[model samples]
Target: MNTTRGADGKRTGRDETAEERADRMWVELIQEVRVAQTGVQILFGFLLTVVFTPAFARLAHTDRVIYIVTVVLGAAATGALIGPVSLHRLVSGRRVKPQAVSLASRLTFVGLVLLLATMTSSLLLVLRVATQADYVLLLVAVVVLWYLLCWFGWPLWVRHRHTSEQ
Candidate 1:
């Protein structure tokens, strides 16, 4: 559906109806959701298994804090990532998909942010455990920088540089 800047929240572009834009947005939303869902599931699985290890019991207080924080972040990410599927199933055929897609996109963004925190903290905990070397913090810092660049920085840069031309 095409949308206009009127009081009604009709679809935004051309003369496409809300249903049409909803359909298109639904497809795009599902594709993005799939990728996020997979990562969150895998990370959640790994986080759950970490508790079974004896080393987990021996973790220092600070490491334990990291573990707990990582688990919470993973849980939040999982919830946000899976929210769209449930949203879709419940609202199917209700003609609310464009709205749902927008909401889902917001949830996915939040999930990604949580995922970033989860991965960073997880790496911090792991590297600290794996290396007693003086460079452990430095190593984690490098990895964090890599993640920030690849995941967030590059995307924003590309969006800023190209989106304007569009």
Candidate 2:
């Protein structure tokens, strides 16, 4: 088997055809989605039950609005995250794995963003109800910043740093 080295100093262990590359990427993407899907599904499920809870009726109007937004975001995240599976299933034998993978990746990215929003809103509502502290917004902002740093910033930095090394 012949192998080529990319400009990034990374050696291609095995030469892969486009289809093979798609197959490998599809598997890797699915593994990543699995982790995210489980979390979002659990959160969405819990959000669905919140409205039926006794405590929900006691929430202020603002809090109830926030809850609705959070639930909607959660539902969207769940749909986006689970989209890849359906996409793959529908296109399984159509010889379009490469395109399917690309679309799925986009959906996964959207799902992650929605998940971030869902978490932020949920936290905001919870904090507002749990305490009258004026620092709740500050606290939520800090957490949002932290999530952005961890979920988006760090990965982007790493990508830039490594790409520049090529």
Candidate 3:
């Protein structure tokens, strides 16, 4: 089989036009977004309830600020994760699907970043409220590094190692 490399260094495996590629990518992007959307929605919902809990009143000022930041990050994550759906709905049949998919993919990436921030902040707040241990900061930093490795490092390594320059 003959294959050509695109400008992005991706080898062409299927004989798809731009529109067909966009359609296929849009479907895949939505499926991926669904997984992230569900997680962020659930997390954001729980974050919303934190303020109403009796324990919330006893939180230190810094912890309260952390909680607020976590909530905001969760909200932003939710918006970004769900942005693709609305983008598709509004742009469907307008012959701009290629652009829409590109934008949606970007939004999904942004959403994931926001989700990471949300989770990190949430963990920090929970740890602060649950313990006075001096190692919480170190623990959180280690966990953040783990998250970064799992969420980004592995995928990037695989991409770089396997992508053939045709």
* Top candidate by TM-score: 3
Order of candidate numbers by TM-score, starting with the best: 3, 2, 1
Question: After aligning candidate 2 to the native by TM-score, how far in Å is the CA of 60 from where it should be?
Answer: 0.6
**Candidate 2: residue pairs that collide:** none
> Model 1 over residues 89-143: C-alpha lDDT tens digits?
9988887777888888898888888888888888888888888578878888898
lDDT of 2: 0.92
Question: Model 1 clash tally?
Answer: 8
Candidate closest to the true structure, highest lDDT: 2
User: Backbone collision count in every prediction?
Assistant: 8, 0, 0
- Per-candidate Cα lDDT values, in order, are 0.83, 0.92, 0.91
The sequence of per-residue lDDT tens digits that candidate 2 reaches over residues 35-71 is 9999999999989999999999899999999999999
Off by over 4 Å in 1: 1-16, 164-166
CA lDDT of 108 in candidate 2? Answer: 100
Query: Could you give the C-alpha RMSD of every candidate to the true structure, in order shown?
Result: 3.2, 2.8, 2.1
- Cα deviation of 118 in candidate 1 (Å)? 0.6
Q: Which stretches of model 2 miss by more than 4 angstroms? A: 1-14, 164-166
Query: lDDT by residue for model 3 over 1-166, one digit each (tens)?
Result: 3344466868677767777778889999999999999999999999999899999999989998999999999999999999999999999999999899999999999999999999999989888878878989998999999999999999999999997665
